[model samples]
Target chain A: NAGVIQTPRHKVTGKGQEATLWCEPISGHSAVFWYRQTIVQGLEFLTYFRNQAPIDDSGMPKERFSAQMPNQSHSTLKIQSTQPQDSAVYLCASSIGLGEDTQYFGPGTRLLVL
Target chain B: QQQVRQSPQSLTVWEGETAILNCSYENSAFDYFPWYQQFPGEGPALLIAIRSVSDKKEDGRFTIFFNKREKKLSLHITDSQPGDSATYFCAANQGGSAKLIFGEGTKLTVSS
Candidate 1:
């Protein structure tokens, strides 16, 4: 299997610009998750979706961050007017279902906001 | 509220030595715990996991000792090698959710 695939493995964006990251989950996987990893905050849970519907997004910043699961095979996380503080590796993972299943992760998209 | 906490921001150990990384959790509902290993520039992978019902789980040289009552657990890597050097993270899941709360990763360096 291809596991999970994330696009633009590395991205550099100027401050105040928008950046969009994409994820294509494994075939037949119904659940997708997003996380932000930084040296200081570690791995922070950003959001999750099940069956193309959002389940939890409490960890996402209310102002500038948004995620969408428009179809079963893909999802996207977009940050508007990114700041230097937003620089971090964005990770996407997928699983079969919501209960106790192992999550297969993608290589992740590293965002560097200048 | 940070449900999980891990200790020793970083550790260095010699080959053939054992390295123990500690973790504690605050959520009583957490029933599943898993350890993940991540190399540079890659996503974290599952190392080994333990359910709250079990006190210990072992896979090859890696072991997880869990204390459900104390809400604490640990990962022990026996016979460490230089290739084993990476960041280890402890994660927990409550009974109802599939979401995992991760701890601040512990970086391990195994020297020759």
Candidate 2:
């Protein structure tokens, strides 16, 4: 298995620009999650989808951040007007089932906003 | 506020020694706890997990000792090796919620 595939392992964007990260979940998985990892906050959940439906996005920033799972096989996280604080490793994970199931993760996309 | 917390941000141990990492959670509803280990430049991988009903769970050289009353749990790595050095994160899941609450990781260093 390729596990979960995240495109553009690294991304750098200037401040005020838009940044988009993509994730391709493993086949047959029903749940996908997005997380951001930084030295200060550690790994924090941003949003999640179950069977291509948005389940929870409480972790997302009130503004500038949004996520969408148009279909079961893929999802995207977009940040508009990106700032330096947005620079971090964006991780994507998928689970075979809901709640407490083992999550398989992608290597992550390292985003740098200058 | 963070729901899960881990102690000793970093720890060092000599080869063949035992290393213990501690974690505690504030939400009593959390029943399933899992530990993930991450190497540099790689995503975190599930190591071992335990449920509230069981006081302990062992897998090979790794063991988890959980105390439901105290809302605390710990990961113990026996016969540690240099390869065991990595960041360890403790996570909690409640009921049927697919979401997890993670604790700030504990960085472990094993020296030969």
Candidate 3:
């Protein structure tokens, strides 16, 4: 199934520049999730979408982070005016459905803000 | 406050030995628990999972022993091999929520 696919396996940007990460979910899956992994925070749930509609984004940073699932095939997470603290491994996952469903994750994009 | 927590941030065990990774949660609403294994540069993959209704769930060399009363669970990897070395994360989900609360993760290293 090729599982989930993430583009730009590695990304580097200036401290103030913006970064956009992409995720292509598994075909026929209805739920997509975004998570950020750091040495200090571990895996933090950033947001999620179900059937192309955003379900919850409570974990997203209030100002700089935003996510969108424009269609069933893909989702994007954008970080505006990125800071050094935003540098981390961003992971994307997809599931057949929500709640108790098994989530398959992509390799993730490693963002480095220098 | 972290809702889910894992112990022994890192562990090392000899090949053919059994490695036990422990986890505990503070939320009583969490009913579904899943363990994910991640290599150095890859995303996490589902290893084993258990529901609150069962006390034990096994899959090949991996098993989950859950204690609902204590709000704790442990993953037991028997006959461990070098390939089993990776970070293990314990995650929990509430009844109807899709969001998973992940623990700090335990890094396991099985030496040959």
Winning model by DockQ: 3
lDDT of each: 0.94, 0.95, 0.97
Tell me the TM-score of chain B in each candidate.
0.98, 0.98, 0.99
- lDDT over C-alpha atoms for residue A20 of model 1: 99
lDDT of 3 by residue, A1-114 (tens): 899999889999999999999999999999999999999999999999999999999999999899999999999999999999999999999999999999999999999999
Model 1 error, position A68 (Å):
0.8
lDDT of prediction 1: 0.94
**Measured by TM-score, how close is model 1 to the native structure?**
0.97
Clashing pairs in 2: none
* Candidate 1 lDDT over residue span B24-49, tens digit each: 99988999998999999899998999
- TM-score between model 3 and native: 0.99
Candidate 3 residue runs with Cα over 4 Å from true position = none
- Candidate closer to the true structure by DockQ (higher is better), 2 or 3: 3
Q: Candidate 1: lDDT of B22?
A: 98
Which candidate, 1 or 3, would have the higher TM-score against the true structure? 3
Models 1 onward score TM values of 0.97, 0.99, 0.99
Cα lDDT for residue B68, candidate 2? 90
- Model 1: CA > 4 A from native: none
Against the true structure, what is every candidate's RMSD? Answer: 1.0, 0.7, 0.6
TM-score of the first chain of model 1: 0.98
